[model samples]
Target: MGGDQAPQMVVAGLRQAQKLHPNISFLLYGQEKLLSKLIPSDDPLRAITQIRHTDEVVTSETTVSTALRSLKKSSMRLAIQAVADGEAQGVVSAGNTGAYMALSKLTLRAIEGIDRPAIAALLPTVRGLCVVLDLGANVEATTENLVQFAFMGSLFARYVLGIEKPSVGLLNVGVEELKGHDKLKMAQLVLKNNPLIENFYGFIEGDDIAFGKTDVVVTDGFTGNIALKAIEGTAKLLSNFLKQEIQKSFLSKVGALLAKSAFSTVKHRLDPHRYNGAPFLGLKGIAVKSHGGTSAYGFSSAINVAVHLIENKVNERLAKDISLLSQHLVQEMENLSLAIEKPTPIKG
Candidate 1:
């Protein structure tokens, strides 16, 4: 009920998800009359799903503060509450991203040892998939926050992307040690020295993301959000260019038809719908936020992400890892501070 298409697309996505994970059950929260009609009696999802009616919904235009202050009984909040109360394993929504993140954080709270939860998603890359984090979760991040993102992102890649020893990289202006600001430079030092974090790949530039230079790319939300939109725009530009070229002449049209299968493969590989879910990592309970304008197929993909996180027990492992690495993180940060405070004088 929270998405652009509302209950219609939501139910359709549930149907697709049900086909993939037949054993999983669903608790739909929306106008019962409308939702009940979407799923026919013969639908398999009907047997496993139970609707919890609610007239409330968080609109795309609703301010985060207003949603938090007044929309307590909205479907989004109720679903997250279900997770917090232990009635559901996870919650997925294609609603207002700010509101969704806020409610999720307020209800489920942050996992112990995690000061802030980051938004992480898998993006298609040349090597396969790369886990990128802080994709608009935090506009600014401290050195400590970046280090934690690297750790959590690496684990996400290991568990979800199936990379045994995921290589982590800090997104920066250049791969050089002195290129980025203080936070990135400090994070690089911390990651490099911390024996707990394996395969620290120093810094990776914007182009490195598409090259899949590392399995996990960590950055503050300000940079990550811009990078994500730019990549998306480039993909669209290329796709449109290809289509235009194919229709320019009879010869080109014939060529495109002959290579239609290859074109289909390329299009499928680049489809944003394939990488729809972005999880709020480091949270106490699982909460996945899908793109609001996506189709049912995309929504189903988000549901798959939530299910995978639950199945992998990602939070449990992350909790233990954070505990073991906290002491090392503090020590590295202290070393960085001291180096900054008392720099050795250079003799010309």
Candidate 2:
């Protein structure tokens, strides 16, 4: 009910998702009269689907405060509430991103050791796919926050993308160690010493993202959000250029026709719809955010993401990892204190 097309896109996407996961039950939270019309009475999904009937919706212009304080009955709020109440395994929405994030945090809360939750999503790269985090969830991140994001992103890649041992990289102005700010440098140092993250690939520049330098890329929300938008714009630019050039001449048109199959393969590989879900990582409960303007297919992909995370037990694994890392750090500090107290042999 919160998307650009409201119940229409939501219902259509559910239909697509239902086909993929026939065993999964769906809970639709929106205007029942409107949503019911979209799904036929004889539809197979009707057997497993249930509508809660929510008239209120968090619109694009809805303030996060308003959504949290006043719109208790909104679809977005109720869906998240369902997750918190243990009625649903996960909740997916293409609604107001800010409102969604705020509501999710207020209800589900962050994981035990997580200072803040980060938004993580898959990006198509030359090597296959990369999980990038802090995608507008927090504008600024501390050294500790960046380190946590790296660990979370790594776990996400391993569990969701099926990478056995994912490599982690901190986003920076340059690949050099001394290039970034104090926080980045400190985060890199911490990651280097942390044994849990086996493959800390130091720092990676903007271009390395497309090349897939590492399976997981970590950055502050301010930088990650801008970088994501820039990459998206560039993809659009290149696609338009290819289409314009293909239609520019009769010879080009003939060439394009001959390579239609090859073109189709490339399009499928680079389609944004294939990577539509952006899960708010570090949260206690699962919540996936889809692009509001995405097609039904794209929304379905987002739903699949939520289902995949649940199957893999990502949140459970992440919590354990965080706990172990914290204990390791405490032990390291104790060892350092003891070493400092035991003075070195004089002139040895």
Candidate 3:
């Protein structure tokens, strides 16, 4: 319902996923009539797939909470519920992101220790990969929330990305400690004090993102969203520029032919289709959220990510680690509360 291609790309992705991993099962959640038209008749894919139909389709007009309330039996809700009930290992969608977030939080709930769920998107860098978190999940977040995101993101890099003691950095205006907003300044302090995040690499600016200065970059949604869009926009602009340059003259066209192989390699390296999905962290079950502009290739990449997350048991692992951390913070807060509540111990 959301992406330009929708069921068409989704159906193609499903076929490709089945070919890649025949054992994996998929529960297609959407309008049955639309899905039936896209699905092939007498195809063997039907054997491994199940369709859960819903009347309501969440659109841009649909408010997050409103969509959740109005479409109790909607496909998105049912898909999330399937994961919560252990019927499915994960849920993938290229639908309304806000609606997906709301429904996921409502159905699967956040992990015990996580104050707010964050969306972590993987960015390809020269070194390898970097995980950028809070990518438009929560518009406003506290210093404490930022600190928690660092820890959780570190764990994700370690367990899922298989990086040992992954470095964490605060996305800021500059490398200097005092360059960012007040929230980031305070967050820097909090992150400095937290022993859980071992590889706290101080502050990193926007330029550092693609350079891979750190394995994880933490920021509030407002800042993270802008940065993500800027990077994506630049990538597209550069690609277009290269094409226009190559078509300028005969000599240039010959040069382009000579560089075609290298250009193709670079395109594949920077292609968003290669990194099309992001995980909504802190949910009880795995939920890989694909971009609304996703193509069949992009959707297929997302399916691969979903398989990796499920096989790694990312959600359960995150839950256990974050739960322990949360309990400690809760106890610490309780002790402070008691100290404030006490009447100075009767002036002892």
- Per model, state how many residue pairs clash: 0, 0, 0
Expressed as tens digits, the lDDT of each residue in 275-341 for candidate 2 is 9999999999999999998889999999999998999999999988898877765665455447546
The TM-score values for the models, in the order shown, are 0.96, 0.93, 0.90
1 or 3, greater by TM-score: 1
- In terms of lDDT, the poorest run of 10 residues in model 2 is 339-348
lDDT of 3 by residue, 1-348 (tens): 346678888888888888889798788888887787777557777778887778867776778878777788777778888989989898898888899998999889988778889988889888888999989999988866887788778877887789999999999875453576766765665566566778899889898999999999999988888899999999899888988987889999999899889989988888898888888887788888999888888988888888888888777777767766666555544554475478532111
Give the range of the ten consecutive residues with the poorest summed lDDT in model 3.
339-348
Lowest lDDT 10-residue stretch of candidate 1: 339-348
Model 1 root-mean-square deviation: 2.1
Q: Which residue pairs of candidate 1 clash?
A: none
In model 3, the runs with Cα more than 4 Å from the true position are 175-178, 327-348
Error of 3 at 109 (Å): 0.7
lDDT by residue for model 1 over 272-329, one digit each (tens)? 8889999999999999999888889999999999998999999989988898788889
